[model samples]
Target: MTLHQQIKAASLAALQALYPEQAFELDQIAVNQTKPEFTGHYTVVLFPFVKTLRCKPNELGEKLGDYLLAHTSLFSAHQTVSGFLNLSIKDQVFTDLLLHNFNNPNFGKAAPKSKKVMLEYSSPNTNKPLHFGHLRNIFLGYATANILKNDGQEVIKANLVNDRGIHICKSMIAWQDYGNGATPSSTGIKGDHLVGDYYVRFNNEYKKQIAALVSQGMDATQAEKEAPIMQATQAMLRDWEKGDENVRQLWKMMNDWVYEGFNNTYARLGVDFDKYYFESNTYLLGKQLVESGLANGILYQKEDHSVWVDLSDEGLDQKLLLRGDGTSVYMTQDLGTAKLKYDDYGIDQSIYVIADEQNYHMQVLQIILKKLGEPCWKGIYHLSYGMVELPSGRMKSREGTVVDADDMMDEMIVLAKEQTEAAGKTEGFSDAELQDLYEMIGMGALKFYLLRVEPKKKMIFDPKESIDLHGFTATFIQYAHARICSILRRENLPIMPDSSHFQGFVASEKLTDAEGKLLLSLEQFPEVLKAAANEYSPAIVCNYAFGLAQLFNSFYDNHPIAKAATDEKKNLRLMLIVMTAQVLRQGMNLLGIRLPEKM
Candidate 1:
């Protein structure tokens, strides 16, 4: 149990003991970190018991505080302020915590959990390359997976590739019409980029065709439907569904190019999937489910022969499952994929890391599955996040205005190189080491900046602000870790110092305000990790890491580890900094950020 949990448990026992006739639960006790201006490590509210016990707030706080000090060694001192009982934790609590876990690598991680989770993210379409918008989704999902895994859940990172549909056909058709049969090798462009160019090309031509039809006096909607490009795209879609060999070959070739490009990007991003589900293979998967639904009268067919489910009773409109031509819709494929995931992995939770725009769609998906009596419906979790926009505006893929992920990464590295050089911290490093450091700093800045905000809030990406060393970015945390390492090296101390070095220390050893605050922050790492896992938010972890780094910096400035006034003081400080570095490393690793030994 965490310190907060332990405190609550202890307070409950005290409350129950004090009032034998009145029943009290753990939830009735509210424990929070003491305000910075307060003189305690944690504060307990006394208002809940005030009314029931017919006692004043401060009176009740005194009763509870007296009970705690008399019955337990948890608190060294207690003070009543207003209606709150602020308790200072015993110095031995922090001393033992530091001595036992300072060098433990898995200090904050939990043991194995019974539940398994399949977290699906980065469901990128083959039609275009991943853009800046996709970065948030990718980082959130990846970091959440790591957090969950560290929290002891069996996590399967899954990627469902949207590698089919008219969008894919659009690129193929464009490649055939406009290209002189140029391949990625021939054009010296990344395969995904090459395919993405055609996707944009198709849109450009599609707009022109629409404009020409409108100029000839056709209604805009009719012109949109009757444009030659649209007609050809529709035909190609039908042919592909009907198993035309030529169309299938072209589809495979283009999707292959996109996959190769996607793999490279995923590698550079340091994310991997345990399994990959392709839309092409699973498009027709829901047809059987639809048949069963129709036979059971749960789903209805339109006059045009398209199958649909009426969700009006569930506060939603009718949802199409299959088209009149018997081809599956996006919803249809999603239904099948949901079942496929459960049948394959028996996951207790199926988390979909999709954007908030698809909130209704995800809702309908779960409802439809539940209506169909599918077991996977209960496990459906939509981790809906907001879109990422630039300072100017949102990006449009069809307009060829989206910021490509590769280009963004390249730019971040360039920024890192410039900042590192400007800081003049590149001494004593070879060319290879400098390159690796640049990549680490650049990628760390990108991931941390994107993840520092709550997932549900839309954010604007500012590259310059993200790499600032003194800001709440990964660069700041990384530099702090490096500073700790430098201190340890200069003092000739082992990275994982022997706990025996502190054997001469006693429980009554006085801790400076900075040392006490740093120890308190370090002790909360596990609790923070647990919160991150439960909330499915890496932002929590980011905040914790930043705070811990800040606390360490304050401790370093206020105390001297190598030249302490006494050997005992010096040993205590050494252990504190070593543990800080270890905790920082573990916490940042959970966010997929690397900490360098030197800046």
Candidate 2:
């Protein structure tokens, strides 16, 4: 159990013994970290006990404090103020905490869980290259998976590529009509980039076609329907869905180009998937489920033969499942994918990491699945996150104006190089080493800044502020880890010292307040990790890493680590920072950010 948990249990037992007639539960025992001005490591609120027992708060505090001191060896002393009773941890406990976990890697990770979970993210469309918005989805999804894994859940990370749809057909039709037959290899453009260019071309040409019809006195909406490009795109989708050999062949070719490009980008982003579900393979998936729903009166068919489910009872509109032409909609495909995932893994939970604009869509998805009697419906979870925007404004994929993921990464590296050089910390390095360091710093900056924000809230990406090394950015934490390594190296001390070296040390030597504070901060690591996992938010871990670094830096300024007044104090200080670095590395890794030994 964690330190807070231990104290809480003891405090609860005290309350039960003191008030035999009054019923009590653990919830009545409220424990929190003592305020900085307080003289203890933890505090128990006496107000709850006083209010329940109808006794004076001060009286309850003293009685409970004395009872706890007599019952456990955890606390050294207790002080009471108003309804708050602060308790200090024994000095030997701090030393034991440091010695046991200082070098034990993966110290904060939980025991393996039996229940499995599947987290879906990065559902990118084959028609376009990944953009800034995709980065947020990918990072949030990837980090959340790692957090769950750290918490001991058997996490299955999956990706559903929208490889076949009207959107994919748009790029295909444009390439067929406008291109004098160009390929990614022939034209020196990345595959997804090449396909995305045609997606834009399809939009531009379709708009002109709509305008021409309007000039001939057709209604704008009618013109949009009559546009030849739109007609051809629709035909392409239908043909591909019907398994037309030529159309399917073309679709496969273009999507292959996009997939190759996507692989390169994913590698640079340091995100991966255990399984990839393609729309081409899963688009026809939910049709069988729709048939079953119709047989059971859960759904109805329109006069035009389109299938739909009425969810008005659940306060939602009737949602279309299949069109008149018998082609399945996005919802149908999603239903099939959800089922396929469950059949494959039998996961206890399924999380979909998607944009918040589709909140209503996800709500309908879950409701309809339950109504349709899918067993996995109960496990469906939508981890909806808001969209990402630029400092200037939002991006439009159709206009080819989005900040491409590759471009953003390149810009971050260039900025990293400039920032690192400006800091004048480029003393020792080879060309290859410098390149690797820049990638680490650059990617770290990108992931840290993005993951730092709560996923549900929208954020504006500020390139300059994100790359700056001195603040809450990933670069700041990376430098802190490197700083500790530098200290050990410069002093010629064993960077990874043997735990036995500190065994004979005297815990009664009296730690400076700064040393105690640092130890206290380190002690919270396990709980911080657990809290982050429970909340399914990387922001929790991100802030903890930054705070630890902040605390260590403050302690560093006050204490002499390599050259303390006494060898005993110096050894303690060295071990504290080393433990601090171990935690920062493990925590940041959960957020998909790497901390370097040198920066």
lDDT of each: 0.91, 0.88
lDDT of 1 by residue, 404-427 (tens): 899989988988899999999899
Clashing pairs in 2: none
Task: In candidate 1, list every pair of residues with a backbone clash.
Answer: none
lDDT of model 1, residue 336? 95
**Residue-pair clashes, model 1:** 0
Q: Which stretches of candidate 2 lie over 4 Å from their true place?
A: 391-393, 462-467, 493-495, 500-503
Candidate 1, residue 530: how far the Cα is off, in Å: 0.9
Which residue window of length 10 is worst by lDDT in model 1? 461-470
lDDT score, candidate 1, position 46: 90
